[model samples]
Target: MAEKKAYPLRIGADVLEAMQRWADDDLRSLNAQIEYVLRAQLRQAGRLRPPVPTPAVEEKE
Candidate 1:
């Protein structure tokens, strides 16, 4: 997994409530739902690039 960064977000109460409901319906956490929505929008706008896969490191015995 890539390193996850944390940033504080400010969302309007009404918007947050709607997202919470949607998240529940989609069986996703609020944060994951938000990211999913944003990623979809970014892809629609041709602004998102495919993530590069990280190579696995072999463990030394």
Candidate 2:
């Protein structure tokens, strides 16, 4: 499993409520909802960065 970085976030009450409502409607957890929203915004703005460290296969000795 990949390690997750934790950070503190500050959101206004109205925005928080809206996010909670969106999460409920989408049947997704709050964390996933936030990630989805951010990714979509980045993609729309063409600011999404490419993934780093191309995947590679390992061979056994």
User: Top lDDT: which candidate number?
Assistant: 1
> Each model's number of backbone clashes?
0, 0
lDDT string for model 2 (1-61, tens) is 2587898899999998999999999999988899889989998899987557768889999
Find the candidate with the highest TM-score and give its number: 1
Q: What TM-scores do the predictions have?
A: 0.77, 0.71
Q: Per-residue lDDT of 1-61 in model 1, one digit per residue for the tens? A: 5588899999999999999999999999999999999989998899998778888999999
Where in model 2 is the C-alpha error above 4 Å?
1-3, 50-61
Query: What global local distance difference test value does model 2 have?
Result: 0.89
What does the lDDT read for residue 19 in candidate 1?
Answer: 100
What are the lDDT figures for the candidates, one per model?
0.94, 0.89
